[model samples]
Target chain A: MRRFSAYEWVRTAVTIGIALALGYLVLVFTVDDPNGAFKWFLWGPLSRMRRIVELIDYTIPLIFAGLAVSIVFQAEIFNIGAEGQLFMGAVGATFAALYFPQIPVIHVILVAAFAMLVGGAWASIPAYMKAKWNASELVSSLMMNYVAFFLGLYFINYHMRDLKAGYLVSYKFPETAWLPRILKRYNLHAGVFIAVGFVFLVWFFLYRTRFGYEIRMMGFNKNFAMFSGIKVNNVVLYAQIVSGMVAGLAGAVELMGLYKRFVWQVSPGYGFDGIIVALLARNNPLLVLPAAFLVGYFRTGAYVMSRMTGIAPEIVTTLQAVIILLITAEAFLEFWKRRKIIREAMKAEGGDVQ
Target chain B: MNEIARSILSAEFVYSVIRVSTPLIFAVMGALLSEIAGVINIALEGMMLMAAFWGVIVSAFTGSAWLGMLAGLASAVLLALALAYFHLNLRTNLILAGIALNLFASGATVFLLYLISGDKGSSASIKSYVLPRVDIPLLKDIPFFGDALSGHHILTYLAFAAVVFVQYLIYRTPLGLRLRAVGENPEAAESVGISVRRVRYIALVLSGLMAGFGGVFLSMGYVSWFARDMTSGRGFIALAAQALGGKTAIGGMLGAMLFGLAEALSYTFQAIRIPSEFTNMMPFVFTLIALAVYARSVIARHRKAPSSSQPLEENTET
Candidate 1:
């Protein structure tokens, strides 16, 4: 198993290298100053301590979202509603922060709890539909995202709109609900600790628990798990709800740790980014940390590159897409493995003749 | 109440419904074809966005809507071919590949738009050719129906015609039989000399073409320019429509119309002080409800007669 994993690691590294080279070629074709663009894309984040700190801050939600997706994926449920759940979490946290300004330490805790509850509630609808009707959670969860987005927009535009603000903005979150920054100089907050803690917690839960084993079994084969007396419906429901709660917590953390108010026009695609992170990590909770950081580093560097080079930051998105496509192409790895096996067999035949 | 009734009953409302449903109908047809062939083309959203962007750019450059549409179709087909190669030949997870492609389309379209137009939001500066609206000569003279049916873009009429075409192709052709056989049991079909991969490729290509038409209509017929992420969630809505339609072409059309009506009603409702957000959410919420209801009915039927004909299992593989 270790040798196979090492082989998989090598294959993954090679795929990533190829994807990056292709992306650089695309940049060369599109941009006049390809060298400058490439420099900024590859090294801008590492060139500054502030940028590195920002990358760390951005990776917090990514870690949570990755873990969220990995959890549901383990149960073989495609609950893509993390995007919606995150939005709903922001809404919940904002509501709590704005409405209960009197409470100090408790207010922050309450807001976090509310975010998780709202996120879980949002996911439960799709979970219910899937459990009861065998309806495609993929479709329902996806459709629900728009509803959640628009609903969040409505709340910000109407109910919580700060009329004095020039643009559409929500009322400032109360000071009492603010999460303390760990590194005040760089604006890093306590959420990073929570994110790191979740890595170990999720790893333990997925690797050591009986429930996690059931989830893994179900993911491996639903019929076999069902015949083995696993209650598939309840497991699916629990997995989706827990996944949503984690995503919701990410939103709440982002809001309290970064923004002063509800200013999100649309989800920043953190949920989708989490999907890629989970995929890169092969759904391993512990591996999600490095995966999220790698993605965050790319994003930060891309942002700086676009700012410096007058290119759109969306170039990073294109690169991410290429990486995802290459990584997920199963045949690429298999083809190479087959060739290696054939070569080894030929060598063995030659040795026997000698 | 009287205001609601007046707006709902107006000829303009019916026209709006038809106009709104046109692109959705195209996407639904595309999704239905792919789903029936056991390849769920969730990349319809990306394909539509790519076509929409290219269709507008090409029309702007060439000064011809037809040429623009051909370019759009070609672009979608190219993406579809890539999807087929990666998913079928490479044995990648189809959903993951589709998602990646959708992300690629979303970013690439905006990136390309910015490079060419110097604007990330839209292509409003470019003067693109719009598809001409056609009024049926004899039909335009009809009393009540004239106002509702006449003077729509040519693509709208084609959308309806394509429904009939798709239905005929899927039901009456030997190709359709082989496609269905391949989807139901690929090994069995292979033994009988049907190429499953080839059928899937054809289905994906046809799906891409229909999605291309939808994208072209969005840019050229619905509006004269492409906006970033303008296809919005319509592609996903079409997927819902396909599922709600039970994988039948005609039913998909009806489902698309229902969503279109919801959108049109939302537009009207906005004038009456209803929150546009709630109205905007109606179609998706309605889809969820419709799906649940459909599932319940199917379950009830199963319980009533265990050995009865299974109607909802046609596209359950994905």
Candidate 2:
């Protein structure tokens, strides 16, 4: 309920402002033409219609990733298994596309359900460990990611390798499985609608549902929730499984909507980006849209900047790091802000009743 | 098949295990110190990255491996100070701060690399000075021991020595006593006039120094150049090793060795024509299985000994 306090908003804004300023300083010291490069980074993505479309297309997957992270983060479990879960989800989608070439509209739904199950199954590995043994899910989940990656690679190399392609890529998805394109030249697909629909769905589920309340209560205080008759283990397990399904859905949509075939050599790194997105959104599903939009803007602008300037686009990573550090730093400007607030309150109550 | 079996049993395999473990050992020492002092530093990866990048660049310019090593340590120490300032002073979440630092280090290293060398992948153009290898006279003359223990990077010897050094520092010294006291009961330690923040800062700094050595070794000893994400997941693995060791310095070293053995086995598997992907996943799978088993046994023990579980519950509460 106090999620959007005025003080918190002030701190968040200041954090982002400082991060951007420092990012410009980095560019100024590195590049020969700093102002020119800055201009390109700030406005390049919005300059052309095609780049804008690309940004929208890119944001669709990011929204799902952010929502994925937001759900589990709300449950107080730090799970980086989304990366691995995404890989499995994509693998499941590929299996569906290659094998189930019969149904028309139903094939898309089948692929999604299968991908969701695969992703949930992958995430349950770390969840089961944490629930059963009190193991730190952070390390186990990260380790599980590598296992998923290698297993996925094994599948691609041995099971689904198309020899005619001359690369480690799987067979193409049937036409029936394709999400109808919104534009002929651009990549605007129905996945955008799906991504937006999920934002609302997650919002409703997290706030309006009994299970969600239990998950949040457990996250707030495990001992308190356990005393209140909540099943702590089940909440922990289901939260992560639900989060993985969102991430898995993102993987499926991104792969089918963008690429002609499944050719990911490594985890697409959307999982890590999702952490940044969730942090930016303050773990609010409703805020995921704008948070993901901002990241998509940065990624697109960075690509354009890298092409025009010699500077690497990894500058955005540094920028986001500063943002995270300052945003989460509780005492960063707290003393000053508190003093000013007290001053205002006293001034307004000079002739106060005791 | 016979040749594969023979190669796996050779002294070279043992040598490779120690060689590969050098970085992890250094990192585990750092992880153990921070963890023992009640600070969770997941930024070892970032510290290593900054150190490795600075080590290579400074050595190339200064022509002294020692100076390069100092520069590396200094950079890591600086990073440690920032983390301490953010977490201890600013009240930032320790884990989140560590994650940010990792991203910062990864991005900043690449950004700086481009500025310095006009390249984004590696600092290969820099003629970085590699630290000299050390060979003890007596050990070098021995048959199997010579092959397995001699002629390693100087930092490799330092890593083993560091294990003993940290073991003594943690269990024998007055400072170590204060550190443990603060970690166990910060309020009680503060009542006794111990500064919890100061002790934690020192712990972070020392761990940074240890992690710095690991990073420096990566660039200046194991290889002659800095590459992107070269430390990979070794930093996280070090944290796992520390936890597995029951948070003791010696136990942490043994845990690191187990992981190192797994890594060495993976490398050997590649020689026998196994799918590299399958073999590459072995260490991670081993870590997961090992961690789960360890966690389960610890839980079972706590259930059996109800009195002992109090401290653990208190540990979780904080």
Question: Model 2: per-residue lDDT, tens digit, B1-318?
Answer: 787678778889899999889999999999888887888778998999999999999998999999999999999999999999998999888888898999899989998888889888899987889899999999899998899999999999999999999999989999899778877789999999999999999999999999999999999988899998788778888888877887577898899999999999899889888999899899889989998888888789888997775322233221
**Residue B311, candidate 2: alpha-carbon lDDT:** 28
lDDT (Cα atoms) of all candidates against the true structure:
0.87, 0.87
Q: What C-alpha lDDT, on a 0 to 100 scale, does residue A312 get in candidate 1?
A: 83
User: How do the residues A1-354 of candidate 1 rate in per-residue lDDT, one tens digit apiece?
Assistant: 013365578777987787678768978999998988989989988888888888898899999999999999878788888899999899888888899754888988898999999999999999988887777788889988988998888887889989998887789898888889887587888899989999998888887888888888888899999999999998888888888999998889999988868888867799898888888888889889999998888889888888899788887787788777877788877867887789989999999999
Q: How does residue B83 of candidate 2 score in lDDT?
A: 94
Q: Model 1 misses residue B9 by how many Å?
A: 1.3
| Model 1 misplaced regions, further than 4 Å | A1-4, A339-354, B307-318
Candidate 1, residue B40: the lDDT equals: 88
State residue B282's C-alpha deviation in candidate 2, in Å.
1.3
Query: Mind listing the fnat for each candidate?
Result: 0.70, 0.77
Where model 2 places Cα greater than 4 Å from the true spot, the runs are: A166-168, A340-354, B309-318
